[model samples]
Target: MNNAVTLKGRTEGFQIILHASASFEEVVDQLKELTVQLKKDTQKGHELIFFVDTGNRLLSADEKKQISDIIEDEHFKISSYESDVISIEDAQKRAREARPKLEVRTVRSGQILEADGDLLLIGQVHPGGTVRATGSIFVIGELKGIAHAGFEGNENAIVLANFKYNAQVRIGGNVHVIENRDENLVQSEDIQFVYVNDLHIIEVGSLHYLKTIRPEIGKHSGGLF
Candidate 1:
């Protein structure tokens, strides 16, 4: 019973380890006992964040809900659940989602181009056309149309284009209309990127600044510059 549920303190946070070989009922019973003891030892009105580690055990939705319901303390919150196993289909799907989708055709007027993950376009987006991505969007040609990044509510997503002097850019819930900018500077051949700043406002900066924002964007590519 002692081995059914174990609690350990780590630098990241407190961890509640569920025994891989223990029966669900036994684990629940031991967890209940430990929670009662912890409640008594802890000071009043203190919040506790715990990471639930299911070592080598995959829990169903109902099972996870059951454990959550059992830990019914207002001051106790479960930050996340960690499992050691993933299905092959899930792994494959993640791989696909991680890879950026690339297209080489112009997005004509009235057309809407979208990607599940990042989108890399080598053609221009005519006015009245729209390009949307669940992740980031990189345009090598003129972007005179609407560019919506993080369409799935990913605030960290960005938009990159050679020049977007007169276009609409959106990241998550924020939007920025590219207009009245220095036509000479913004119309340059060098790449410029658009992102959401700390204050949640849209910002357009040089390509070099992208490394500081998302270093991983250069993973498959040669370099950020």
Candidate 2:
């Protein structure tokens, strides 16, 4: 069998890395073998979280569901399963009213950071850097990279940036594409947040306005972390 899959234990949970270039059949075969190994190694009467880390490949919704079905059985009662596309800091952070804050000097090009819950970042997101989360994402500095929030289909997720017009911003299944910049267009200095409206359109507004318009937007139930 091809070594298309591997498992590693993370501080938050277990991560299963699937080779991006492997065929779907090869991945499935590896997963079957992995399940057997995991079942035998797992201690009796204990629960754990498992995450699927598809490095550069994006799994379709159907593919994700198939993986879930494979791991469902009597021996492995997975407390939670999630895509490692977004990073979850820790379950411990969920108990607090405040979210976990990541203070980075700079997220350089080709770097990626994922979170399972609300995340506060105090730094710059350079071009090509990526930030993804299952919940809201707050950037206190310039955002010049990609920011994806509500990764697990949470429509209420928001993306906040100190400056306007970052590289790209996507929330859930919606991509906020910017086009046709007027010759006189000017960047704003206001702190802004992006959220999906009820109409499914991505909207951008001042942070204060968003909070006032949707106070509930700030409220979020921590997903499996």
**Top-TM-score candidate index:** 1
- Lowest lDDT block of 10, candidate 1: 216-225
> Model 1 over residues 36-101: C-alpha lDDT tens digits?
999999999988888999998889999999999877579999989998877677776566567788
What is the lDDT, from 0 to 100, of the residue 158 in candidate 1?
90
Off by over 4 Å in 2: 1-98, 178-181, 217-225
Candidate 1: count of backbone clashes, pairs at least 3 residues apart or interchain: 0
Q: Write the per-residue lDDT of candidate 2 for residues 57-86, one digit (tens) a residue.
A: 667779877887777675554444445444
**Lowest summed lDDT over 10 consecutive residues: which window, candidate 2?**
82-91
**Number of clashing residue pairs in every model?**
0, 4
| lDDT score, candidate 2 | 0.75
Model 1 misplacement above 4 A: 1-14, 29-50, 74-79, 86-90, 180-186, 208-216, 219-225
